[model samples]
Target: MIDQYSFLRPWLFCLDPEKAHNLTLSNLDRAERWGLLQRFITKPIADPHTLCGIQFPNPVGLAAGLDKDGKHIDSLAALGFGFLEIGTVTPRAQPGNPKPRMFRLPEAEGIINRMGFNNDGVDACVARVRKSKFWQSGGVLGLNIGKNASTPIEQASQDYVFAMAAVYEIASYITVNISSPNTQHLRSLQSEEMLRSLLHDLSEERKKLSDRYGVHKPLFLKIAPDLDQEDIHLIAELLVEFGIDAVIATNTTISRETVKGMEYGEEAGGLSGAPVRAASSQVIKTLKARLGNALPIIGVGGILSGADAREKVMAGASLIQLYSGLIYRGPELVNECANALRR
Candidate 1:
């Protein structure tokens, strides 16, 4: 079966990355409407795991970028992801960078994108999730929120707080995304001083929302894979100090080392896929060592196979997520990787 599906890859790889992504997502949406996706693909692995006060049927999750606006949650959920993360949603909707902003590095099983955090905004995203049958199922759903592109760095925390308040009602977990490389100066938010202040404010907001809604959802911070050991240690210290519920060990990286000679390697955005495995694993290991069971870590980046998934778990990731790997390996990758974890 996997061999038969291999034929689809060459054709999918031929199109531009962004267009190929839209086409794939649209096809999945259609498959869900016809009730055919499940017949063809097995359901996600069902070994339940708990983290940060929520239960996930499996450690495998679909990362944030793939379903940015919460538009295709039902369809994506049907593809058998244990958890779905939607959006790098901002306070206000904004059109991101101009076309040809996404590139594929097939040679490295990687993708480079500078989409600039394009999305339909937090309110619309929350509304879509609320309306979706997927959310109603009580499946783990994470909202990855970011600042609007035009927002100044000084006021970025305001945007995070605003989006958090807007989606707190429906989100199973909320991820504070300060690592997207496409946005101008967004990574700067990861600095110790800036990150401490941001998490401090967001932490207070989470408590208030928990009290008001009578539910305490985990708040996780998503950092970049581009950080060095020093950077990871500093951020981990603050994560502990701020009482954050979890750490999403990585977002896409700005490093071009993996796809050095590829045509798209020089594209100006974050890179994700096979090449990121080593760097991302290092981040997870460092965090686990520093925080030592105090904070859970969601390992993501370059998870292309079962071995890669197992490596992350060994490195101390309580859960794992994939975006670029799914694009390259297809849905079977999910079950294959999860089954490996069970062993």
Candidate 2:
């Protein structure tokens, strides 16, 4: 039951946020191994939707950043996610920003993390994916890629191209992540000039990879929730122009207007959860208006309930994803959202 998480939240909150995060995943792995997960977790509803040539079992998905290394794929899939996305992974392993980089704002149902792209690198993540039963069975997995922290912003395209080539054959679709706020200057890739160049390079690389593999893998761009009307319009135009498969609208927000005056409210990082629900929806609604059906939108931000999930669809998202919501609502939230989005 979803209330199981409510019971456990108090104890988890007592520990440091990152430590609690790791402990939860570690225990989940054990539970899945012992066959306890399938017994306790509800099965996801069957509501298949096809986009970018991949058939999703349901519209609700586990967003990237949770399983940064593909370490808990089989375990997380047991919780009823229709699809699972992993990473913000880079070309090389990284230690990330520093300790105490993640903060929780229980009063506001939000989390702020500047963990950078802390991951074990793309090669390791690829190996883990290859070993996964889910991937072996052709699960719809999206590999979110990014550049190394040490790489200059000007040469970031090289890093994206390198990572994309590594996961080309294994991924259901590749998400070019250029919106994470944690990495210094990472968000600069969103600028029209820089974005155009990056997209050009990625498109060229995709052509070569597709010809080599004899199958076309879709590319989806992940954008921030912190853009203006002008930026949104420009991005929508670019997506259509480049023939991008889909767009993941509204990553974590740097704006703290909603959670101000609360504990850890002023922490320096992108804020997610309920505080971002409205902003993310607004972005989805605007993108839908501009892009229409020329491109699909994968809405992911502060979806904590079935109603929130439906709202994303109402704003024209073909699919939805969850991250912080899992921390607050637990595994049952997956089934709840899937059922709500079922037509």
Candidate 3:
């Protein structure tokens, strides 16, 4: 069935990209509250897949950065994602970079965003989750955490730990977002020494949180797709050594090779969508070869269709996520991917 978003896309595209994003989500929330989504949206086929000790209704999920505030969980969940991972939320609220920080490369079906982890803070997100129908009903929720821009890079671990403690009770799993290129000095955390140090701190903290809550929540590390072979291998080794429960093969790429001459192609932010798909798949492929079953890979990068979703799976992603794809495609893409992946 054709999705309602296809019809709305042209009109939405006319507005500023960031405004269009906020408007679409805001309307979705209102539509959901009015009980109109179920009547129009197709439900995703149930293709249960378990990862990190949690059973998801389907393998398709909404990637982080889409709903950074956790304000639209129920509305978005109504769109048929098997799970929803919200935020690159930080310990404290931040207004993000500035206006026009998000740009659309329509020709390449991609987005360049330097929103800089804008969020209403972790405490606010946890409060929002508590009231959401999805979270209340036990829908799988992954909370992505990051450091505040004001926090020095060396003390980034403190910000992460603070946010982790806040959301630990509500999140089905926690994603350490150390790879967003928009943040200054953030990707440096992906380097060997910094990554090892950060993971060590988080690993030890997880033990304490698990003991305190009497529940073990998996930790997922979201990495950049810009790394070379050596970087990928070392990350794989560190993930296992640190006992991280899973890895999100990619976040977004700083590379503009695919969208070079297109409008806003030269924008300085992570380029996500069709442009980053291949690189993301390669990362998943390498990680799967090295980590095997020892670590589950949650593949996410440029999935815009069911075929794209399958490619990630073929590369060994146990599950897949969508963001820019959702912008270019529509809500129906969720069902398309879920149906394709259904065994």
Candidate 4:
């Protein structure tokens, strides 16, 4: 059962990370279909917060990457996340990097993954989102988009623009993810010139989509945790200049100082979980200082407890999200965070 994930943890941990993830979602799907998930999934207490013109029932969200293809929306929503985000879905489907791309560092309570935007593509993901009960449940849903791995850095906007067009009508908001380190040259999009062009193109496209759908869906930019003063300042400037809707700070860290010698510590992928907590909060702090009220931030990265979630909000995050924490703590972290924020 979902809440009884502790009982299944040992068995799930025995399999490969990706395989375990697939099994978990598959079982969740089966449970939801049988109407048995509600027994295991707790109802998150209500604590409304609105950002990007959308009101969330609560602030704690299930971050993107867990349901890359939007396949388990209704089932995953049973966990009581205030909102749910799906995909890093691209214009085309592609098998990501080779096997063993995801590694669990249990000792460090972190995970390293280079799963390069491997989704069922924008079309399938959109169709699935349109079909999910969560989509029509009036719950906040964000569709995170990214360029395909094979897409060149020079023409990355094409993939983002295409994916945005496909999901625009249905998503409560769209997240432009240019921060994942797994894709080659993907983070290069965060550079000033490229970042400007990417935001500019998406902004322009949003206008047309708004007119076509008669409603505008907000566009949030997801950034990486490894940033400096210059990087943060320029990104804040570009976001404001382009009128981006919101920002999801600190995707995952390429920095490994926190887990250097631990098993699977040297793996070549972005690191997340307890290891990235401080780095993510600091990014939120910096962005809050620069953006002020001009933009709102959704803080994510390494939130494993209520205090960690509270620290993010105290640091100026408009809201927070979880990925690795959910993997390590199970569904209870969702309610723990919701209650913490309510207090």
TM-score of each: 0.98, 0.99, 0.99, 0.98
TM-score: model 4 vs. ground truth: 0.98
By lDDT, rank the candidates, best first. Answer: 2, 3, 4, 1
Stretches of candidate 2 off by over 4 Å are none
Collision pairs in model 4: none
List, residue by residue over 234-317, the lDDT tens digit for candidate 3. Answer: 999999999999999799999988987788999898999999999999999999999989989999999998999999999999
Q: After superposition, how far is residue 216 of candidate 3 from its true place, in Å?
A: 0.8
Q: What is the per-residue lDDT of model 2 for residues 1-343, given as tens digits with 9 covering 90 to 100?
A: 6778889989999999999999999999999999999899998768899999999998889899999999999999888888999998899999999889999999888999999999999999999999998899888999999999999999999999999999999999999999999999999999999999999999999999999999999999999999998999999999988889999987999999999799999999889999999999999999999998998999999999999999999998999999999999888899889988884
List model 4 lDDT by residue over 1-343, tens digit each: 3447778788889999999999989988999999887876778878899888888999999899999998999988888888999989999999898988999999999999999888888999989988888888677889999998888889999999999999998889999999999999999999998999899999999999999999978999999999997899999999999899889988989999999889999999989999999999999999999999998999999999999999999999989999999888888889989988889
Q: Scored by Cα lDDT, where does model 4 land?
A: 0.91
After TM-score superposition, the amount by which residue 291's alpha carbon in candidate 3 deviates from its true location, in angstroms, is 0.9
Q: Of the pair 2 and 4, which is ahead by lDDT?
A: 2
- What do the candidate models score in CA lDDT, each in turn? 0.89, 0.93, 0.93, 0.91
Distance from true location, Cα of 111 in model 1, Å: 0.5
- On lDDT, the stronger of 1 and 4 is 4
**1-343, model 1: which lDDT tens digit per residue?**
2564588888988888788899989988998999888788887558999888788988899999999999999998987788999998999999999888998888888888899989988989999999899899788899999999899999999999999999999999999999998889999999988998899999999889999999988888999988888999999888888888899978988887778778878989888898888999998998898889888999999999999999999999989998999888898888888898988
| Global Cα lDDT for candidate 2 | 0.93
* Candidate 1 global lDDT: 0.89
Model 1 RMSD in Å is 1.1
